[model samples]
Target: RVRAYVPYGKQWYPYFMRRLAERPANVAFLLRNLLRS
Candidate 1:
């Protein structure tokens, strides 16, 4: 289901974008935690 993924307001856009751009690192961090369990 490919739909337009526009963010609602400008308030959280910057923070969300930054996290999205760093998704690889974020995933790695999560996976590391998962493996630690």
Candidate 2:
């Protein structure tokens, strides 16, 4: 399980993108949970 706190603002997208880029596994984890819901 992974958790994060991202302030909602103009910088949010870039911040999330950087995180996803840093770890491709994050993308897979996200998709897995999203589809499970």
Q: List candidate 1 stretches off by more than 4 Å.
A: 1-22
lDDT of 1 by residue, 15-35 (tens): 766775777787678679999
Local distance difference test, candidate 1? 0.73
Kindly give the stretch of ten consecutive residues in candidate 2 with the minimal lDDT sum.
Answer: 4-13
| Model 2: per-residue Cα lDDT over 1-37, one tens digit each | 9997866888988898888999999999999999999
Could you tell me which residue pairs clash in candidate 1?
none
Q: Over the full model, what C-alpha lDDT does candidate 2 score relative to the true structure? A: 0.91
How high is the CA lDDT of each candidate model? Answer: 0.73, 0.91
lDDT of model 1, residue 10: 65
In TM-score terms, candidate 2 sits at 0.77
Name the weakest run of 10 consecutive residues (lDDT summed) in model 1.
4-13
Candidate 2 residue spans exceeding 4 A from truth = 1-4
Tell me each candidate's TM-score: 0.38, 0.77
